[model samples]
Target: MKRFLIFLYFISSALTALSSEKGIIDLADYHYNRKEYYYSITESMRYQYLYPRGELYSQSMLITGKSYYKGGDSGRALSVFSECYNRFTDSEAGERALFYSGLIRIDSESYNYAAKNFREYNYVYNNGIFLEESIINLSLVYALAENYDEAGKKIAGYREIFPEGKYIKQAEELSVLIKEAESRPEKSLLGAGLLSAVVPGSGYFYTENYMLGIFSFGTNAALIYGIYDGYKKKKQFQMIFFSVIEFSFYNYSLAGSIKSAHEYNENKDFKKELVLKFKSEF
Candidate 1:
């Protein structure tokens, strides 16, 4: 009985030492597999700090970023993914990092940037496990960036690349949506400006410049009130005062809001034009 107890005590001590040495890797992996991303990230970070050159460092970085992304910290995830891409270029973890970085970029409204990363991932891991997903995103990135021409070309390319893609239905629907967007006539800011000239504040409404219109209306009201008070006081100087204010601030705001409405339209049109240009090139 004494010998058995001694043997068990030594075994427990050995296990404790082993766990102390590999707690980061083992605990992180265990947490990650169980979908406990927050805990996984914590454990993985500890492992990374203790053993920067550990074999699991690449995975640790990858999972750390994944945890941040899942926890709604896309900016931090992007930063960590970039680090993984730079530090573990030859590892399988690096491939996943690059791929996921593109996805996060798209979500963060950096479509152009995501498109570049997606292209790089596609080239580096040609026909790899993520090939289908990468190709689908290639089309989607262009579309989200408002690059209809690029989106269309990429869609066609995707069809050729993945004739039987898992997301064929989704890709087809996206292709149709892009075509419809291309058909719509781009709105004209110059037209909006002309419309405003005919009807003061019309351009403001067209351009959704509500605050500016309110300011214009308010200024006009103040000018009228000044003129009325001057007439009541029988003061010639007050009439001139009201006239100056009416011609200056009130008129200026009205004209400016109309002009701004036109400019806003032009800027939106320019964005659409850029989208078409990107499509043709891509």
Candidate 2:
């Protein structure tokens, strides 16, 4: 009878412990669902403290990382995710942690690191739940880093690997965007500088800065006419002053044209478009 009673006591204790463990994670999840990220993190941390070896340990850690991420604490979130991935590399939670790490890196504009994380995830998890997403983001990271050729290759590989994938449409769209970006016209810096040197503001026109071009041309023409008039009228002071001003303006115009050419090539529009597409699709 005593042995039977002791066995019942132990079973009761085990059940209670199990319930407590499950309860804590459920509370964390509840807070997370309600967007109470602070409370979610608190509860998740509590779970980790109370049950270091619990079956739900990975889940609690993941929730903690996600809460940090949602709360705009990317550095902490990344640290947590990296730890989770390192500790539980074979678990579902680990896979998700690695995926989120990649996403955070992307947001931070650390494209190389983001690409590495996504590539590692793909390599480690052949059948990962986030496989399609990883592939797409890998391509996006490449594109963001301005490696459009590699980006195109990644998208092509994604299409080949997952023809009916969930992100197939996004892949197709991104592929189109990459092609367009590649084909977009680029202003030549040498051409712009040479044009400006030959004709005051022609370089600005070459880079499509019509207003600046007009303004520059007018200013230079006025200065040149002033110098000529001064010279013809024997006004030495006026001629020398106009000549100095024109020289200064001419150099300024040349420099400005070269800078504009660089800006045109940088082309923020394509990057902005790509970013919007990534955000919308993801």
Candidate 3:
């Protein structure tokens, strides 16, 4: 009986090992397709560890990195991508890992790092599935880094290279947007304030707050006129009362003019920056 039980235990152990080895990769793929990213990572890593020279070894590493990225662990995702690409150079999986890592870097706003990876990708592969995407991302990274001239050049060069490419319009639009951001009016907060001090309400006009400028000028003119008329009539008490109101209005106009100048410039610059923000891919 003891010998029979020992024989049965050996058979069961062999069957379990065979099944685990064969099904490991398939299990990882199943989890990845279903968006069970954590499960996918576990199984993919298991395959990589147990079968380092297996047919799907590179694929397992790619799967593991992709799972980490899609599962919202960017740090781990980058680590895995780096390891896999380094381990399996000059292969589809290596190129794919590099491309995905670039995307992850771009998402994190690491424009310079993303640019390096994309440039390396271009250098490594003459042409492949990610060629167009890498070029497009390079243009975007340049723009995000505020290298407007470089960004424009990239866009123009890409258009020449791929006139009928799928993402040509996006690159062109980015170039146009960069130009728009560069042409912001050079009006200054200090200059606007000083102008309004010299010529009441002219500051708002300079800042393009036409309505506020008009209202400021009209209100100040009325108040000053009232105080002057009170004084000319020799109504001392009335003049003093109106003078107090005029002083308050006068102080507010000066301070408000400076504040309005600041607000207008701040809002103008904010909108200009939004052009870049909207164009940048998340």
Q: Would you estimate the TM-scores of all the predictions?
A: 0.66, 0.73, 0.63
Note each model's CA RMSD in angstroms: 6.7, 7.3, 8.1
Off by over 4 Å in 1: 1-41, 70-75, 204-282
Ranking by TM-score, best first? 2, 1, 3
Q: How well is each residue in 1-282 modelled by candidate 2, as lDDT tens digits?
A: 999999999999976764598888998999999999999999899888988899999999999998998898999999999999999999999999999999998888888999999999999997999888888989998998889989999999999999998889999899888888889899999999999999999999999989999999999999999999999999999999999999999999999999989988988777777777774221
Predictions in order: lDDT: 0.74, 0.91, 0.79
Model 2 spans with C-alpha error above 4 angstroms: 1-19, 193-202, 209-256, 279-282
Residue 198 accuracy (lDDT) in model 2: 97
Candidate closest to the true structure, highest TM-score = 2
Count of clashes, each model: 2, 0, 0
Give the per-residue lDDT digits (tens) of candidate 1, residues 22-49: 6567777688778788898888888788
- The 10 consecutive residues of candidate 3 with the worst lDDT sum are 273-282
Candidate 3, residue 41: CA error in Å?
A: 0.6
Q: Which stretches of candidate 3 lie over 4 Å from their true place?
A: 1-22, 185-282
